[model samples]
Target: MSELPLNPRSPLLPDRHPEPDFFVADIFDATPKGDQASMEHPLFTLATKPDMESQEYRHGDIFVNIGPSPIGRATVHDRDILIYCISQMMARINEGRKVSRTMRFNPHDLMVVTNRDVSGRGYLNFKQALKRLQGTQIETNIQMGGKEQWNVFSLIADATIVRETRDGRMQEVEITLSNWLFDAIEAKGRDLLTLHRDYFRLRKPLERRLYEIARKHCGHQKSFRIGLQRLQEKAGSQSSIYEFRRLISKIVSDNASHQHIPEYDFAFDGDFLDIYRREEGGALPSPAKRGLIVSDSARERAKKHAKGWDIYALEAEWRDWVTSKAIEVQNADAHFVTFAKQRGPYKR
Candidate 1:
């Protein structure tokens, strides 16, 4: 990664590209594939620069879907690409193009962007604009007579912050999909692959190099040799990193961890080591990363408890030790030993 300018609001991720297969021809259609298709009908929105950055909690599921390891893999098969693919959909709308596709209850395109500034005001404004044109031909018209017909609809400012639970309970905690993307983009520039590298600019040297690595991982993160193995386990998730920092930033404010350790590097799902090796041409090993690799014996010991624990579970315990102890928890290894040993021999 390049020398970051230390700007808190810096654009974390470079530009993204569109996905090859945007979506199922009929999102609502139930094929033999068996995935639950929504019958709510397809909806379209236009993505704008503002929507790129925002904090909304409706994103937990979206982030899980588009991140390295989606909660439901089928929903967002290629997350990084999905990032740009969404932008592409937006561009199509901006260009006054027509998007004719079958739909059910799925976002037909990545048109609904979360503005990078002001808590999703762009999307919010867009949505308001939408409700106004309900009766006129302007319903979904983004351009008056330009090209694309994308129309902005409604946006929720900090939309997810005040959501109601299934039990009809409301909470003040709000999160957004843009926040997740911002974290993912900022934490590590490793996955901004060349697939669409031309779209973004990285001013920091460290960040630039990191993107080089991210580009590599996207190709093989799913490969059997290293891809699936990653699912074996990893340090922790990026959100964990943010939670650690947010806890402290609210206290005595120090910018030490300003550059957080992105979830990709330590997290189990991202292929940090693989991309590093490939990026560095197998020389100049990343000692810190290599050190994290467990010996087969240690790994075997950990695996024995795999039923009840994994490396990540230990790290989570380490994190909870204290949002107050981000430094201590830094050594996830200490946690591995402490946690793995406590598991004792499995009940064979």
Candidate 2:
């Protein structure tokens, strides 16, 4: 068969020499706090297209319902702005400096933080990203105060391009973040997680999603394991089970070879997958423990109160759930009993 012409559309292929649509330097200045990243929201789509279809995702009591808007739908790539903004704000907070929702920054600075180029086309893409963030509406049960109330808001409240280059490249940009997002930053910095600088370099959406799960769960711990089935559910991926398994196995193998993925390493043993942080010296401090402990008496009470409930299984779920939330429970045993009642008769 004759060799097919190089695919102009594929960015990954070196032989594919697509004509440059824009001129921007690919190198980025990964400065201090520049490589810092944060995500206040849970895992969402990794789609690059502006999909208008409405979708709902739920994990436990947390729910995120994305609605269509006239401007555009938010793509997962649009999350770059949030990661940059939140990471900067967190840096300030860490330094005992106050922060606010409205931020003024150079457009190029954002590109550096997100590991993008500073080209004319890149500037245009950045504006489009801002539009999607401002236009996409989300209804979520993520609380603002101490109450559990539904919040309806966009990812960004407003954006202003303050200055532009003679060639129409955006220079200064001002952003007013949605209250829902700002509240997440102010309420507790710990609610946010630091992502690797290479996160922006991840080309596949599913790979990004898996990395988020690893960052959230594994963090500084020696290792953490999740069943393949549970991981798929958590990812909310649409791929078939066989395809997902193959995809993940390949990622693990690839990561082992290159060690390109930051922060954590991936591995799988049979049905269980493990994520462990790389043993780099000067590890950032882990989040404070919840101090939740399941006592033997609590186990006894769980067995007595909830007949046919597996105490050990319930205890594991309770511990895992609370640990993920990073919250302490005053009464671990009583809480376990209540949780058991809700889940009742645990499945193997």
Candidate 3:
């Protein structure tokens, strides 16, 4: 058998906490989840350096205005903190524990899970990210958690370094999520998506944004196609069409060679980008065709059966499994409940 060649370039970020035991005891097994609202919009900047620019995006009736603080608009990298907190909250929910908007955790744990640096410099960067998150103001009409009211809020309502090391590095961190974000998390199944753990290891801001778009829109479907101009708008890239095309070509070529972008593969056909799932299963059927509607009662039962597992994630997996196995499920809800019961619980 011919062997696949190894990637020639080194990974952009090293695995800071390679050992399983390195994470905090409570959240070592947490699966990363990204809020659907931010994933769908251009809430973050792609600039590697501090970006002191205000931007506006309008899609139909939804309008978003983002204003940056002096330090910069919150970059995509800064979103990692929010992802970590969201993951923690989801984990708690799966375990049937109550979760509040405000969260407290060891700063090291955040860094470890996000594949970030743990040095003194890393702590300083963490502090800066918190500042950007708290200072960047957003005004939007988008509703989250079913609340539909206009509001201006920062990414985080508040943040504090609760403890510090002798060298002045932050030890403990507490963050109060903005009402907008907190509402999304509280909405549960409708407002969050599971992220591939390697999302933290992506080298470029554009790459990260692209992955978020795919993870949000393509999801578990067989494929999703979008026009290049439309994709540029979704990605919030400031580059012109020509420059964006060049950048995307480079990314497409790189991903083709390295296969580093997780979950999905990318291809460009003329002016449209095609996103295809890497797995071999066929596309999921429509809910109507598959009788895929799960009753509230069934959801409760599945939760009990798959304790500590995100029920929506399991549903996605169940759908993929059904398609892959060519199972003609007559009673989708009952079959999913059985699948959950058989899959059993996972350690939180």
Task: Provide backbone clash counts, one per model.
Answer: 39, 0, 0
**Candidate 2 Cα lDDT to native:** 0.64
TM-score for all predictions? 0.23, 0.66, 0.77
Candidate 1's C-alpha runs over 4 A off are: 1-90, 97-297, 303-312, 319-335, 345-348
- Give the best candidate by lDDT: 3
What is the full ranking by TM-score, best candidate first? Answer: 3, 2, 1
Model 1 C-alpha RMSD to native: 19.9
Q: How many backbone clashes are present in model 2?
A: 0
Ranking by lDDT: 3, 2, 1
- RMSD from true fold, candidate 3: 16.4
lDDT of 3: 0.82
lDDT per residue as tens, model 3, 71-107: 9999999999999999999899889999998999988
Model 1, poorest ten-residue lDDT window? 33-42
Tens-place lDDT per residue, model 1, 1-348, is: 232222344233333323324353222121111001000001111121112222211211221111111111111111222343333333344466643211112221222121112224533432333232221111232222223333332211122324434743332322222221232223222222223332133332223223333434433463212332231112111234434233222211111112222212222222222232222243322322222322334445665654443334333333334343433333434445556677655355
Task: Name the lDDT of candidate 1.
Answer: 0.27
User: Which residue pairs clash within candidate 3?
Assistant: none
State the weakest 10-residue window (summed lDDT) of model 2: 29-38
Segments in model 2 whose C-alpha atoms lie over 4 Å from true places: 1-43, 69-72, 144-147, 281-348
Error of 1 at 291 (Å): 8.6
lDDT of 2 at 298: 61
* Index of the highest-TM-score prediction: 3
